[model samples]
Target: MAEDLSAEIGPDRSLLLVDDDEAFVKRLAKAMEKRGFLPETAESVAAGKAIAQSRPPAYAVVDLRLEDGNGLDVVEALRERRPDCRIVVLTGYGAIATAVAAVKIGATDYLSKPADANEVTNALLSRGELLPEPPENPMSADRVRWEHIQRVYEMCDRNVSETARRLNMHRRTLQRILAKRSPK
Candidate 1:
């Protein structure tokens, strides 16, 4: 991890990290502090929006979904309060449409979930002149689909019928997919 990212830290080192996963956000906040940020954490969309509105941060890492609502709501509030805020939207349920929506709503970048502190930092510091290098081993299409289905299944409380209905998939087909191990 690169130290002394003070150059990238805006007028203030204030950073907001919002995610529903308490452990993950806590760990990421500590990692960011070591990299020279003053991170404030929030575990829900309402809390995140309140923090962003009360005091817009110089940089933000927001989750795409929260217990209360979407993380994009917080992103929008921050952008409205501070036009120059560098915001990154993180999502466990990664999809091209959501990525585009995040960017369209003023997010600086969109990252899939399980992103490391370094990856988030790089995203915050990116100038957009150069494209990021492609992943050494990107997920295969089948793997991506499987991941999506699994995420939806979890989101639907592991109710196969609800998950299948939400995914527009037949219940039996969804069951078959759920029964198998994840593709690499």
Candidate 2:
């Protein structure tokens, strides 16, 4: 009789971590390993897709952006490859439009960037549409405005001048806003 290699971890504890940020991937992978998950990582959608084809993960944590393409591509592929895979989309550029699109494509949940590993594990394991409670102290209006400006700046491909123009704010003012630390 052949011994099952998967016995070391629970059968469904395998995971895929897809993100272009190497540091984030490393940290999350280690944390997931400590949580009994065997996490395999890929920095691009193509690589993630190949990994899924060879061995579908039981859970996945994907970044919204990647070096090669959007992470939604990977989420869709994972869903197609294995309907049971639970997926969470993480983005530093969180916005309602993309979050809705991600869920529509089969992600289990959507989370903003800087989320810790514990939060991710909870998200992956939790069932149904219920989400963790929101942070007691949410972002201030100024912080929200800053984040929205930053999101637009990023979408404009980091064209600061263009972002300032789009936001109908002066260039120097935009720079000042970008330079300041986010409010608590």
Candidate 3:
């Protein structure tokens, strides 16, 4: 379901964006502004917290890793200060463990980095809403890792050598990993 933010910010919203990546943050802030959000950028968790405390925003988008501290810390602080605000996390490596940890620590939602403007906006809009039921057992760590490897392999067009090179793994090791994941 889409978020009903009309009551919060009167059809226009303000946001706090926390990330150490200057380029990415700048680009995303501009994109969000075009989407009707006023985005305030912070390069670290401390700065993000300070900004939110001094001028509480309607929502927040935080990166998982920062130069000073983890984004989860910022999310926690935001939740404490503004219980009604939505918090979305961004992860670059897309680790399932980290995503789960973020959610446990008060993040409203999470999206892997390189996400486009639409994806980010949608995640923000749907924040704090119950997600659809996950598949049985869902995906485990090994399954996620295997899927990452498979995606990298396909991006390299199934060239094991290129895939391994891109992933910083030995060709033979990559072969072994893929072979081990093959069903009997």
Candidate 4:
């Protein structure tokens, strides 16, 4: 993280930090404040939405999963209310699915939890180049759907019938989709 980012963004840029974890929010807010941003903390999706709608912060740091709702909803709301504001999604271990969804829905970037202060700061500073335009994700929606199906397939131990049953799809339909996705 560049130490001069605070000077770059100046003291007027307001940052909205939304996470259900109290301790994490406190530490993150303090770190951001030191970098010259005015940090506001919210503990739930509802409160975060309310704060965002009312004040419209210049930037937002959101958690992927909230106690009340998924962070994607918050990202959508923020984008709707503040199109110019940048949003970074925070994810916990093994929540890449949620993080990817958040990015697809308009999160500027996604960072895994236990992220260092420098990591968070770097994410914020890099917003200038990363946001205002959506990032390219090679993982298409169809790819994600197939990946989910593959997980179920593996969990079912390669039992087509069981995998189809678990996914609430007919065996033939699953086979057809998988076949269509397979390389020639």
Candidate 5:
């Protein structure tokens, strides 16, 4: 049966976009506005919480890592304040563990970075439906490995030595890889 998703999400056009990257947030906020949403943006978890608390947005697009703290904090706060708000967690460093954690914490969907406005819009509107399928030509193996390494590095609090040890890789090599920008 087709679920009545609109009823749960309501007709509110308010959207809260929380991400530290100024360019990314700005671009998305503009695109969301073009889609008829009233978008309010914040760069950190604290700011996101404040915005959400002041007047909970009907929807949210949150980055996994924020300057102040994990974006999950914002998700949790929103869930507490507005259980019906649809949230989509965005992350550059995607991982199975984090995605599972996001959904467990009440995010409506978890999408990797480079997700365009249309993708986010669909996620925002299609709560309770099947998740969007992974792209046919997904990230290459090397890119996936780099993303995983980055995830572990961040999980260990950005300690290169610890991450190297955990990955059983040489410290210098890990550093070299970390220094390079992520693969497309």
Candidate 6:
């Protein structure tokens, strides 16, 4: 699908992938390259910004948080350099506020982490006029709860008490949940 779209956009097909997760970035890069893109990888906001400034890509997938800085900064740089760039903001800790901010700042779409290559490709190539198909197998309620708790825990600097307070959950309960493996 992306091959057809890439063909229309000429041979450039340059894609910038910025994520602090080295393994995820490497995997995505290889997958995207197979789908007719020329990929460039970066592991920090600073490196991403540098690449965006020097050579803006036609397509980009940037993580929401990075070790050096916010990925929004990289998105801003890309938007400034390439007005028509198709950018997707990927985050593990998805929130309405951050999603809204990403769209307001020129992100084409916001995807939660663990999105497969096919999902990412579709998001990149799909026209805004059409609605995306619903996920065939949405996460179960238990999984969703687990994800939310994990996100809150990470936000609280892994302090169980702080996270429990923020979530209105008991600290011991939070600890038990944290100790358990995430649900499928």
Q: Give the TM-score of candidate 5.
A: 0.72
What ranges in model 4 sit over 4 Å off?
A: 1-4, 127-184
lDDT of prediction 1 = 0.87
Quote the positional error of residue 95 for candidate 2 in Å. 0.7
True-structure lDDT of candidate 3: 0.78
TM-score of each: 0.75, 0.70, 0.66, 0.68, 0.72, 0.71
Looking at model 3, the pairs that clash are none
Best-to-worst ranking by lDDT: 1, 6, 5, 2, 3, 4
lDDT of each: 0.87, 0.83, 0.78, 0.76, 0.85, 0.86
Highest-scoring model, lDDT: 1
Which residue runs does candidate 3 get wrong by more than 4 Å?
1-12, 127-184
lDDT (Cα, tens digit) per residue for candidate 1, span 1-184: 5487887676699999999999999999999999999999999999998998899899999998889987989988998999999999998767655676789889999998779999999999888999878879989999889868766765675588999999998999998876665566
Q: Give the TM-score comparing model 3 with the true structure, all chains together.
A: 0.66
| Candidate 3: tens digits of C-alpha lDDT, residues 74-134 | 8888888888777889967565555666787778788887787778887777745676667
Clashing pairs in 5: none
Model 4: per-residue lDDT, tens digit, 1-184?
4254666775558999999999999998888877778899999999999987898888889986688976777888899988877788885632344455667778877887778767776776674554445646566676667768766765675578998999999999998875553221
C-alpha lDDT of residue 22 in model 3: 98
Per-residue lDDT of candidate 5, residues 3-64 (tens digit): 23344345788899999999999999887777777799999999999988889998999998
lDDT by residue (1-184, candidate 2, tens digit) is 2223344435778899999999999999888887778899999999999988889999999998888978988998899999999999998767655677789889999988899987888788778667456889977887778668867876686677999999999999998876665555
**Per-residue CA lDDT of candidate 6, range 42-112, in tens?**
99999999999999999999998888878999999999999999999998767555677789899999998
Better of 3 and 6 by TM-score: 6
